[model samples]
Target: MPCIPRLSAPHFLSIALAAASFGAAAQQPQLSAVDLARKNACMACHGLVHKQVGPGFAQIAERYRGDAAAPARLADKIRNGSVGTWGRVIMPRQSLVSEADAQVLARWVLAQPQQQQPPAR
Candidate 1:
């Protein structure tokens, strides 16, 4: 006969609580720059508000604020980098994103207002 270890009531409750906490955290939409940067590999080539190999999110946001279609367009440009946009340091097209991911990034970028915003006229 094999002896099996049983979980105590306290142990089970702790596990349940941990699981519930994780579930709640997951349910909360990660509409944050930290989350976006960590999830999308932004740190690989770009910093939060500084210049890395590429421009930062703040620069992008400041450049495209108040334009409704700007988010969609920026997302598309991220997936497909352009020339002469930021000097000759061309950003290569990222092949690891979906439209949904792009939208998330775009929304996150647009949400940041730490820098200057475009004219409201």
Candidate 2:
């Protein structure tokens, strides 16, 4: 028969606390940017990797990669929609999404990785 080592009370308490902490973290909202976008119907016009009615998220990230004010600027643009940037396509003002949520979404978009280019042959 194999003898199992019994854990000390402190060790058990620590393990239980760690697991409980992880459970709390898991309970916290972990929705991704894409999920938020979808929930707010932004996916109707934009996409993560490809263009639909508007430019894709990756393209937007590439366009604003160097600008330090991209997050704030994009957040404003989201709250108050504009035209002529991508084309004549009109982005209606997003009144339903809260300003804080708009900023969160904008930050998420800005944090997206730029599209990778193919290596030279």
| lDDT leader | 2
Q: Give the range of the ten consecutive residues with the poorest summed lDDT in model 1.
A: 30-39
Model 1 off-target regions past 4 Å? 1-33, 116-121
Off by over 4 Å in 2: 1-31, 119-121
- How does model 2 score by TM-score? 0.70
The models' CA-based lDDT, in order, is: 0.78, 0.89
lDDT of 1 by residue, 1-121 (tens): 9998899999999999999999999898745646755776877888778789888878877777788999888788768867678788787776586677777787787776676457899
- Model 2, span 6-120: residue lDDT tens: 9999999999999999999989985777777988899898988678999988889989888999998898889899899998988889988788889989998888887888899
- What's the lDDT for residue 86 in model 2? 93
Error of 1 at 116 (Å): 7.6
Give TM per candidate.
0.62, 0.70
